[model samples]
Target: MRRRAADYRRPARRRLSCWIWGLLVIFSVAGFALFVLHHNQHQEDHVEQTALETNTKNERVVHKHLNFTEEILSVRSYARQLAEQMTLAKAYVIIAKEHNNFHLAWELSSKIRSCQSLLSKAAKKNEPVSLDDAGPIIRSLSSLIFKAQDAYYDIATTMITMKSHIQALEKLANVATVQSTVFGQLAAESVPKNLQCIYIKLTAIWLEKNSLRELADERRNSLQLVDNNLYHFCLFSDNLLAVSVVVNSTVSNADHPKQLVFHIVTNGVKYGAMQAWFLGNDFKGATLEVQNIEDFSWLNASYSPVLKQINDEDLQRSYFERTKDMSLEPKLRNPKYVSLLNHLRFYIPEIYPLLEKVVFLDDDVVVQKDLTPLFSLDLHGNVNGAVETCLESFHRFYKYLNFSNPIISTKFDPQACGWAFGLNVFDLIAWRKENVTALYHYWQEQNADGSLWKLGTLPPGFLAFYGLTEPLDRRWHVLGLGYDLNIDNHLIETAAVIHFNGNMKPWLKLGIGRLVCSTSNSHYPEKLSTTLPQIINGSMVIDAKGPRRSLKVRRKMSSLKYAIKGNQFKIRHDIVVSIQRKSKREM
Candidate 1:
């Protein structure tokens, strides 16, 4: 009885002990896993809350980070480094060449070429080329060329840093006695001249034509615009061809051209040409009134404070001087600074006293779609209907204004956004009520000392119409045609109006065959119609040397010259016709 009792007790005790141990192990493992899960969940929740709190603050950081000062400095530093590398490589090539070391010279030359390509890409394409990759710095000329008063200012800044390196390399090459022939060759070959020359020629032809009175007399009173329409479109341009393109495009595309009335305000020099062009060209039924700004004797340099400041040679020189760092492009510095016609739009309400509302268009723009909708837009009592530049991520007030000045920085928000001047729907009544003219004059006088903002009338316009501007749809006006060659084809097709806002005008010789056709998918008037009868097939490059050999010679002169690649089409008035004949089988 004793033995049986001991055996049962021992077995039961062992079983109980084993069961307890197993239960303890299970609890310990489960507790550790649960703790880990809780900790992870807490970390995720904390992270989410932190992100939510910091989102707007992070945006501010991004804004400050994208400032112009930092951007320009980065560009300067990167450009300097690249220039130095290029100079050094070129120097090495010269040394190798002097030594008759062909292999070494070739290797160094290849490296130099590669460096030049990267440098050119930075300057031309605005592409970020990595110097050492803290990040890639973009030294873009688009803003300078298209928007800024002094297009060469940024170029001048980069050039200041590049001069020492260029000099050092030249010294090395001089010592080797081989010369920096590559740079010299590149200097001659790199600049694309045909398009530029063509542009200059076309403008020169328009400006220098002698028979102004005869041209004016020919079309004196055939069909003058009444200026009594419910809706009017105003244009200010010096180019005759550009005006024709704009009016043609508008009338052709409009749902009712007869309802539209166009008021063209041009300089005295171009008025005759404009009148002659309009008189000869068929406008379907749209009425066009041509007004010579000079005819309004009251509107002189003294009359308009903006014109007074704009014409100041000393003030203009302060903004546009030929520095060692500035671009040597003759068109940028030498051309009349901010043409008088560009400033004429500021006097719209005064110029057209009777009109309640009018749509103002720059000559560089072409209307592809009907604009009757623009006339119907409410505008909510705002004076202006314009495309807001801030909608574009890259475009901001900082792009145009010098925010370093306290007057500008405090008065205007750097990130407040800006509007395009190319295409605008202005409420003349509202403008008069607000005395926008007086405000514009006030801003112009304030900026006389260059204290407020630098060149261009748009800055003053921005000040005048700040609160009164109503942002229109981006589709109404598509810009950057002159700056961006690879502008989206889809954007061009969908846009109601396309604006060529830079130096590369579509009427230029280079532009005649390519840019206009590429952007519009329509034949340019120069190539198709009787725009330039003297210049055959848009081939002759109007060079300083006077009369080139042939189109073949011009084509051979530079491979970079955009060749007429696509099939030519005939554009009669607004209609674009395919010149290619149908196959006999189809007929």
Candidate 2:
């Protein structure tokens, strides 16, 4: 029995040995094939193969070209040389700020910046040490470094001031006297007496490039977040802060009362405290209470993007899709180009636990002092949410709307509607129900002929204005861009509204050639240079956009006594008989 068992086991052992040998043979063949492919003696015919090792070695040297350790010192020596050149350029600008040639400093400043930018890119790409690396180029250019830096900063600062104006004004005397006091400063500013008006010219360039008022508004808004107009909300916060101090006392393990108070206030009890009876940990003061912010947005005011046409179809589609259906059309007239823009902003009790209101300002506006006074305003009953325009002040479209459908309102005044009038705050929810925007858009699409003759949308505004004509609770509305020179000081005083009505933009052919920028306005002197040639003093000789041919010239040429310049009028090919025939044809 033992021999029989041994014979069976011998067969199994032989089979296992055969399997192992097969696997070894397969692996050995694969290894030999891989070795033959990898070592690759194919370099015998190719020149690149011989050069590969040297090329790789050179690349490594280039990688460390500007580093502390390197086989080649020239690469690093060059980057250092460039850096030194830049330092010298910076030094020159510091010295030449007041000189007349200060503008020449820009050459050095721009070059330095460009070199730094290009150098950074080359380093990122691991480019080889060469002229492109900047070191060699700067070394050659270093001779001018001393002269260049002298005027650099002065010119740069001058250019920046001409464009970016965040120069804070010192408000002398009490802050309360700001309004009237500011007017004096505006009027008292001395005009430049220079023949060329260089400062004025620079101011125009700045205004054209940047929006000064917009920048100032943003800066003010950011600062206002720390302390805005929220009396009731602030009081509530103060109360909650006091309660937090009380709750923290029992949880702290502080020894003395004073230290305990500080610990409770600063550290807030140990956050991962264990329940007195339970074995596991528990959290204290984890529940958070958040307050609502006062949120407001301008409604039903005109947006130029809605009224303007940009040639870009894709951009138009994006704008159309992004904007909700705030229609710009009236029932009477359909302006094909105008747009209706609106966005939703509301106080959500769950999202913003702090109970309150918020205000959305139109783009063209100036906030004077604190907005606290306006926050306290309330319409009839307890209408906490309000829009000043709805009080019957801001209606251009509203007037037109009422005129379209006389039945919409009995007292409808087509002329008085949303010309500059605003709408109710609470009415936003009600306005969304009727889809009036869609109705206007449909009216516009059906009748649009790309002309401004009819009232497709503004008619409803007039109707609405006539129907609901009431003075706004507070004084604010859709305003013009300082049309009433008496009421609006535009650049000098804080404005409630600076309506950029239609095409009366300061930059346009109108408005005396001024452009509104972020913090200030710019005037164009070159407008005269370009347009003066066209300001003809005599009767027009040629139409501006027509062919140059004159009726008189055509008639006079036809009456000429001699043969005309272009044609022989008779066949020239043949024979001596052609001269006589040609003369008769010319006659």
Candidate 3:
């Protein structure tokens, strides 16, 4: 009985222990599952927080880029406004100086300098400037300008009533006129060093080559010169590059290049260089004849009043040398007044007597279209066909001729329309019948002392061809490319010829930037490339690779070889190839 009781106790104890172990296992599994769920929730929260932070950073970078672009745009706008204001300030300063208001000029200039300083600082800091920063100063300047203008107007009105003041004003006017004359004289006479270098280089090239001496003597197309059936164009110039541009532009635009005849008359000094340039290059089968003006023995001082004027020592001193008296008329000091080339237009009848009609082109002009149609135009018995320059009657006969001279006042009306000389079609038949050369000579003699008119060929030309000029279409020749910056681009493109008839010649450093592009498009002498880098502003070192020779240059070289060798087949092939290449480029 005791043994059986002990076995029952042991079994009960074992069952109790087993139940406790099962509860422990269940608790452990539940705790582990809860821990895993808690960890997964924490990790998901961390991942969401990281994505939000990255998105914010990306947005900040994009916003920064946009802000930077806006700042750049704002800076450009500010700069443009500043430039305009600066220009206005300069004009105001000029006016103040002219009126002897030095205090106002100094004040305005100081303000402008301060504005410039602010701009520089802003630019250095890469900060955008606001136009409003200059607003208060500009408003103050405007008010000052208005006040000064009012004061001047009052003074002008007061002076009109006072006799003594009027006399003083006249004296002041005379002084101002004299000062202006001196300024103009200096401006016109001063030749830039670059132009001098070009002239020297071209002349030196001619002098160096003995083979180029007989270049202009070639008579290959002598009969075509006087052939009335062909188009005859005459140019009188001393500038080799200018002549080249005129010839090149003409030949490039011509419909029938073979029928073109160009007769260039230059001074004795430039004859060799002019001849060498023309002979070295081919003008697309156009006949080019260069004549030395000194060769015409009949164009002596005894017969030509201009030659006499050129020979006068007093005239030479007054024109070529500086003097203490600034009162000399600016026109009197112009070297062009003494140039035989300037006066040669009057002797065109004598120069090409055989040609019944001819077109005269100035060296400064660029032909834009085929000039063959000009020869076919009828003059209706007029000696000259020209574009009238009297849109507002500003360029009337009175503008050129002195109305005080009875010979001019009685013969020509002040309101009579004037014509330009740069481009003209001359009727040699009528010119000879009217003895126009004698008329020109008579007018030239009358103006020898320069009392009748200013010292330019235009005045004499106006007198000689007073009633004999036929008005041409203004589109045929557009003027003011040199001086008028506001000329329409469409007008320039559509015009047959554009004239650079002012001080800002296309070749000069001071030439208008846009106008220079027109001339730069034409082929320049290869030597010009080497010399141009020397004169170009800023850098002294030449380009190591040198300028790339243009396709036009290669074509020109090929044409030159053909001209020398007289290879008809090769020239024809080259022309075809050039035409095809040009067509492909256009396409």
RMSD of each: 20.4, 36.7, 23.1
Who is ahead in lDDT, 1 or 2? Answer: 1
lDDT of 2 by residue, 12-36 (tens): 8999999999999999999999888
Q: Which scores better on TM-score, 1 or 3?
A: 3
Model 2 / residue 584 / CA error / Å = 76
Runs of candidate 1 exceeding 4 Å displacement: 1-229, 315-336, 510-514, 518-587
lDDT of 1 by residue, 1-587 (tens): 46544454578889999999999999999999999989866765553443233223322332322333343345244444445445544544454454576776675566556556666665564444343321121112211112221222355444544575578867987766533332332332232444334344333434554454455455444343434444588888766556766777788777777787888888766555456446434576777777787788888877788678767876466435534544233333423345677788888887877678888998778777788788789999999999987867656777667788887788888887889988898988898999988888887887777666656667888888988999999988989886677777677667888888765565554443344543235433323234332223443342223243344444432322222211121222211011111111122
In angstroms, how far off is 337's CA in candidate 3?
1.9
Candidate 3 structure lDDT: 0.70
Number of the top-ranking candidate, with TM-score as the measure: 3
Provide the lowest-lDDT 10-residue window in model 1: 575-584
CA shift of 30, model 2, Å: 99
* Candidate 3 wrongly placed segments (more than 4 Å): 1-116, 119-128, 131-198, 201-205, 208-210, 328-332, 518-587
Per-model TM-score versus the true fold: 0.56, 0.24, 0.63
lDDT of 3 at 156: 49
